[model samples]
Target chain A: MRTALRLLGGQRFLVAPLCLLGAVIVFAASAPEFLTLGNVSNVGAQMWVLALLAVGQMFAIVTRGFDISVGAVAALSSTIAAHAVNALGPAGLLAGPLTGLLCGTLTGFLIGFLRLQPIVATLGMMIGVRGLALLVTGDGQVVPLHDADLASWLAFDPAFGLPPADWGAIGCILLAGALLGRAVLGRRLVMLGSNPDAAHLVGIDTARTQLRAYQLCGGFAGLAGVLVLLRAGTGLPTDGAGMELQSIAAALIGGTALSGGVARVFPVVLGAAFIQAVLTGLDLQGVSPFIAQIVVGLVIVAAGFLEFALRRFQGFAFHRRSWT
Target chain B: MTALALPLPVRSAWRRWRPGAAAWTTLGVFLLFAVLVPRFASSGNLVNVLRVAAILCVAACGQAIVLVLGGIEFSFGSSAALASVVGVLAVPWLGPAGGLAAGGAVVIAIGALNGALIAGFGLPPFVVTLGMLMAAAGAAASLVGGQPIDAPPSAAFAWPAAGSVATIPVPILLGAAAVTVLHALLSRSRLGRLWYLAGANPVAARLSGIAVGRVTFLGYLVAGAFCAVTAVVLTSRVGSGQPNLAPNLPFESIAACAIGGIPLAGGEGRAHQVVCGVLVIAMMNNAVVLLNFPIAAQQLVMAVVIIGAVLLQNAGSLPVMLRRALTRRPNA
Candidate 1:
């Protein structure tokens, strides 16, 4: 029991599961329909896009920076994918991730080699990508998929109690986990974020690591874009306007330190799930969507407070242990 | 030694008169627009450009204050929206003047709350402001049912936005006044120095007994006051309360500061820099409209200009690096 307590205390993402549990309990009690299998499945299906985006965001945040251009990049990728699909059949879906890779590469070059501030560089990319999305479709017209039936089948047809898209998202997330946890490049990213001077002294290529992190971030956003296309059966250039904030909120709530160098993929996915649950629960209760937004925002701040409290608690625990 | 000594005074003199990269860029954009776009150089169009820039400039003054304190405010857009909603709602009970005052108070109160949370709890300013942004926007939307509410037309209410004193538009005058006040606060006051010190190095400032927390709180509060002024003017101009009013205010203000060559890393900015940046953006926007470009081209052009302008600010190092590379090749 003491060992378990110690383990829980040491875990950075302890709050994510706790928060998720608390939300579920509160929602299940307040709304009788909250725990229904239909709603559960509905939320599970809906959360994959956010899950992918948040996982991607983890890469950037772990590098002590963030990319605010993900939503715009996703929208742009979706538009490109839509056009490609129309021209080359369903095989054209590859266009989305590729476009995202190209955009990410540009942003990475600016931030890495050119030495621009991450926020500023990403802000520029956000605007430029949004413009590109609009320009391609002739002033923000939605591009409908030619193969809507196939897209819907992949998005909604349940296989092994989960849609193909959800399975794909889970696969992508686990791959991200492996990359972040086991790969040398991931260690370099964390090391650079934790202490740039030390990383440089140890001969880590800080610039290249940052570039790779952003590339991963952009690539994930592209995958999210593709998911969006699959679900909506259309390319929406303006759809992801405020999604950047939501993804950041999810990553933060998942226990990714804003000060950098700490993250876990599973907890971050749980964070995204918590957000979806809140929105879904609030919707079940007939509350306005705006109120849900407010709750989500408050939850983000609460997450920050939780982190602060956890740090204080750990300090107190350390003192107690040392005294004993 | 003689050559170096001779150039010292000349360099100092040049520094004294030399416009910053932002200022020069503003001038160049202005000249380019004047030449390329017909009717852009007309006095009427110039006034229109300034008028449009006026609101952005006022809000950007608030943004500049927060940036100098090494913090960012994402709630300005939403807070302005909330203020407008409250202002219009209070109009039936409170007179127009009172309504406006109430609206200003709402913004100030929100600012004070943000200040208290950040100062008291040691919260990250970004997280706190972003939370406030969401909550405030939700409140605004809920109050008005996500629709715009029009205030009963009144001459007194319109005066703040429409009234001119001796051929000067009120917003322009207000914008200039805001710049002047910011200049005085940043350069002439003790609190301003504290802000700079705290922003540059908080631990050092704290160790020096500077009360960094209080300085930060006051900075955000002052920023709120500036935003309140903007909200009031915007409400008056539109003659209605809009839940989505000025949704881009925060981004635009931050962009203005960036374009003006104010480092986001904090510890340095000037009033003239803000004006120059605002003018550059305003002129670019005006030229885009005047050029009759497709709607999509506007955002594309804006994207290029923002990146290009920021790149230009850092261009001073490029030439030096190039020269170094050239010099080293011969030795190799």
Candidate 2:
């Protein structure tokens, strides 16, 4: 059971179970409806978009880089996809995600290949890409997809008596786990992230590996954008506005190192779930939307504190060496 | 040394004025806009450019100080937002001057928090400042209840965009004054020496009796002051303290300074370079505005330029320069 928990990975599992169970126990003790399957599934369904973004962000963070442009990229893909739906019918949906993937990959390439600093490079992308998104949408959102079928189905459909989006999110995590744990490219990505200099010395094309990280990340961000659009049935500017910060928080909460090298996909997936669920719970509890952001800020502070504490205890040293 | 042999000081002076390639490229772009775009050459537009660039320059200057001390700060946005929100709110009683003072003080407090966390407690600046960034943003937004507060109706505030002396924008004047003072401080003062010492090698500086932590704290304090001044100027200019005004500010300033030649790894850069960088970005934005490029076009151009600027800044030293020169010499 201990190894199961450990293998399920990192400290991510511990936090979510503890928090979710605590919420359940408290709410159940008080309201009795908190432990219901209906409420739990609702929480999972709602976390779909943010959870996807967290997966993309986890990749960037685990590779020892950061992506502040996810919000912009995601927004661009979602908005563009919606805007193009009028032209391409079902095919138009692909337009936004493709553009999003291109932008994401290019941004990653700029950071990885051009030797530009990750944070600054992504910051530039956040500015330029967001503006580009606004431009593509003519400074307005595509409020309704020309064909909203796929979006509607993704948002409202149920599969095997579970919310489709929630199940889809779980499936995405499983795929990511396979790619990262069992694939050769995944191992190379891990090596490049853990120690680029050493990887280069060992004949690994570190640059290629680095670029692939961004490419893979951007593709996911693009897909996440599509998922968001599908869920919302439209594209909104604010969709990606501050999502990067949340994504970073999600990845960190899931126990991925910010400086990159170690990863536990299941934990990050759960982390994303935790965020969505927590925010949903707060909303249900009658917390105002704006004020609830304080919770996010608090969570981020807590994560930083945890990182600092872990560093102080030298708890990460063992893991750090293994990955490198 | 023989007279024909270039005096080392003279050689170093030449190096200082060598005009970095990025500097020249950006300057060339500026000139092209001035010549090609009539509106860009107008004094009014030029002053407006200065005015806009002044906000960035002020923020970047603060950022440059921290960068110079071998760290980075993202709390500039938060500090500016907090000060802008709270300082102007105080203007009903405190007046415009009070707004400036209050803003400066609040930013300093934020800066002190960042410094204490990073230097005093031995925390990473990225984590400390990132945390402070969120906290400051939240606190400021909450303080103002997420609304805009009108600035004091003081024409005295206009002095930044256009000082009493005809034709100078107060922002430009203030930014210039700051650059001068900071430049002198970096070159002449004991504190500047300590900052340089710490930035160059924290361990060595500590070993040599330099109070590295205090120097870091001082750097952040100065950064806070710089942000405060920008807040005051921006509030005065915009005629209100909009809580979300500094949304892209931290990134803009860091990019400007970085594009100008300041490396995030720290040490071996000057504040003056940041001024040049800020001007380049401001000019680019101004030119785009003058040209009436759509927002998307602007973003694309700006992103490309940013990447180009980063590349130019990171290009190799004299040896590589010589090799390039030789390669070009054959063509010329």
Candidate 3:
């Protein structure tokens, strides 16, 4: 019984998910319309974007690096997509995903090859990409898309009561999970993150592994941006504003260790959903949007504390003994 | 606190001039801007740049101290916001001195809370400060109803920013005074050595009988005091208590420290390096504005410079990091 209780309190099963459920139960009880089908779909739509970003965030976090520039990449990708599609028609659709891929690859190359610290490198990229996005838009105006059919197909057309964006998010998560779990490259990346010195001794290509992880992260962020553009039928320079923080919060809350070498898909996705649901509930209750931002920030710190406490309780000692 | 004086380690004077690259780079960048951009070399623009750089320098001063101790205060920006808001609002009832006290008290209280959590409870500095950032911002918003508070009609309020001593702007003079005190504290005082020792190796420092927790706590306190001081000056300069002010200050301040050759891993940096960094960023901003570059281009250029500076600073270690990854060992 004690063993079963211990197993039940594991990171994968408890902590974040319970907090999420607690929030949901409290909010659903308070707000009558929170559980409505329409509201549920609305929450689902919001969850998909953040969910995608969170999954991408997990990749970077697992490598002990942060990709704050993901938000900027999303903004740049959407703007580039809007311009390309306007100029070349359907071929522009290819521009969105490709832009994301190329941007990710570039970030990976810089971080992996140049040995730039993750936070500093990604911050530089974030600022640069955001600037480029604004430059493309000119005067911070939104880039309106003329491709209505594409927009409808990407965002509005729902099959089996779920939109294509949700499907895309699910697909990305599945693909990422498989990459992290089943692939040889993914295992090497984990080992690289777990102990760079050990991995080096074992002849693991740490730099290349870092490159692949960041590239994948960038790709997801870029794809997320394209989805946003298609849904809104416009590319706003500020689309990715505050998203980097939100994604970081979600990924951390989902239980990805900041020191790297650990991640879980379900927790990350659920973390994103929890955040979205809380925001939705707050909106329904007429709380200020700024308060939501505060809540998100607090949630991150709270989750960190919870992780520390859970680890202490579980007595699962790792290589690094110090919690802080 | 008195035990901080019990430190003696044989060291050369070489570490004092360690951040020479940043200082030299500032000079090089200044010359480039002076030649390329018209009016950039003019005394009027130069003083204006100094005035602006002074504010960032003060904030970065605190950040430099924290970095030297292997911690960070991400909430400095929000701390300034809250201080300015409370300071301004309190001026009408408490007078200028009282208002300043109120602001200082609030910051000190927040600092104590941060110190307790980080030092006593072993919470990570970044997470604690990040939470503080949001909470402070939210408090400021709710307190002031998201509106800018005008400075109280008092001579004390106007004197801080408007007054000058012997042709130097008061802000510049205050900035100089701050730098002098901080530099002395970090280099000449025994407390500074404790910070360096603790940051360099916490376990060793503890083994050497240093109260690492107390030192860490004091570092946060000192950082908070500087940030509070910055808020006071910013409030006086702008002549208002705008809650929205300095939203991006912490990022720029951290970037300044990084460019000044302060390692994020900590245990090495000086007060003068921060000033050098602030000047570099200020010159860049001045150049962009003078050249009439688009806002977008300005941001891009600033980002590029920050990355370039960090890369240059870490250039020595790059080869080692790369070789570690590329090296192949024989069978384990």
Candidate 4:
């Protein structure tokens, strides 16, 4: 009974898995069309951008930092990709993702190397980068990608009849999970998140580890940019607004601690999918996207609260006592 | 108090430097900005910078108080927006001061809601205040009917923005006057010191018989009042109460605080430093605009500076942090 109570009381870092389950159930139960092949693929397609952002946010969140600039970077990447797609046709295929990766990497460098708080550093990036994205694109208009053959092959085509981007996202998830979970680099990254000071005491190079995690995160976001551009046939400067918030929400839900030290990247993917599912369900039910945004905000706050509450009940505080 | 148990250098330095570090950092940032930005040190530009920093300072200084107690007023954004709009809508009926008071009252009521949810019900500050952030934003929208409001022009409202004091912007004067009062409240009053005591360590404060709850309530109340002051300044500056005067305020104010060395971590930091942080940000913005740096380049620079400032500030502690991070046990 004590064990059960304790289990009940603690916030299990299963937010990602649970959110995935909840999203699937809620969408499948409420919207009959949601379970259909086209719709699930649609979900998958929508998730392409979010997944990349999830990886980006995962690194920052795990390090007890935030990269709110992910959204901004996404916009800039999308804008850049849009222009690159127009300029290079099929050959410019790699440009979009590369732009995003570079943007994410550069921003990450500032945060990790300069030691700025993730949120502020990213906030500045968020405001300034978006403007740059707009400036580059000449406005909010998306530059259409003319390479239908390439777009279909790279974005929509499926190796096993699944959307190509879905497979790509899966690849991303696996790669990220392997990097975070199994690699020596991954272990060091986790250690960096756990406690920079303590990691330093034992000769772990905190800065380099952090920089690598950020680099990986940026790369993932870049891939997400490619997927988004391919699917939409165009990229808008506003493509990734508020994406960082969603990614953070998904990561926190997926069971990653906001205070760093523990991470589970696969769970983060599910969390993202779950959140998208819930939003899709709400959209089917005639709820406005704005309302869904509010719902997403609520979910994040709830997830944060749960983590805080669960940690409290177990008599093992992972981080400082936050307003759970 | 735990430090009291320790002898010599540790306790005294903690009491002295920790309290004033934020202020020194703020000054340093201001000086840096004034030197770095072209025309940053110019008298005309300096006044403009001060004017820009003043309204935020009014809001942030109060935020500093609440943060000291570990309570965050995310509601400041919505409340300021709401106050500005409601005051505008009420001006025709209630006169200027009355309109201001009416807006102030609404803010206080909303703050009351926040206080009740947190203190009375024991809801976490994050949840309670986040809820307020949403609810207040919605309320502001409803009050304005999703449209901009046209406020009746009044000197009482305009005094803050008018560059009336012999080339010195009135907003700067207004901000200075407000800061004078806030500084006094924070430094001179027993209540203020007690507030810091409560923030530095709540359990210790409680053990010492301080009314922790009351302090928290008042701290939030003060936050609301300060938000009202900012609302007044902002609305008057635009000569109307635009519902979206500062949708990004919570982020901006917090960033200013972080950059100024008055992070939300609480206890330490001071108002004098807060003004400097605000000036630094304003100057940076002015410089970016003046230099005509492409937005991206400015972003890169801004990002670098922010991260650099934080790293520089904590460089001495890096070695200690590294040691701690390594020794912390892995998930067994």
Q: Give the residue spans of candidate 1 off by over 4 A.
A: A1-11, A316-324, B1-14, B319-332
Off by over 4 Å in 2: A1-5, A8-39, A83-97, A315-324, B1-12, B156-167, B200-210, B314-332
Q: Candidate 4's residue-wise lDDT over A1-324, tens digit each? A: 667534433346455566677777777887788789877777777876787788767876677666767777766676677677678665565676677667666666666555555556667777767777767776566767766677767776777877766786788778888888788888887787777888778877666566666666666666776677777777767677557667877777777775576777767777888878877778877865656755775676566566656756767732354412
Local lDDT at A117 for model 2: 79
**lDDT, model 3:** 0.79
lDDT of 1 by residue, B219-281 (tens): 889999999999999999999999998877887888889889887777778888888888888
The DockQ figures for the candidates are 0.40, 0.31, 0.46, 0.18
Order of all candidates by lDDT, from best down to worst? 1, 3, 2, 4
Give all candidates' CA lDDT scores: 0.85, 0.74, 0.79, 0.70
Superposed by TM-score, candidate 4 places the C-alpha of residue B128 at a distance from the truth, in angstroms, of: 6.4
- What are the per-residue Cα lDDT tens digits for candidate 3 across A186-261? 7877787788788877876777778888988888887788788888898767788778777887887787777778
Q: What is candidate 2's CAPRI-style docking category based on DockQ?
A: acceptable
lDDT of 1 by residue, A255-306 (tens): 8877777888888999999999999999999999889988988988898687
- The total of clashing pairs for model 3 equals 0
lDDT of 4 at A316: 75
State the lDDT of candidate 2 residue by residue for B56-150, as single tens digits.
88888888888878787887886787887877787777877776678778888888878877677655566567767766777777777788877
Give the worst 10-residue stretch by lDDT in candidate 4 chain B: B323-332
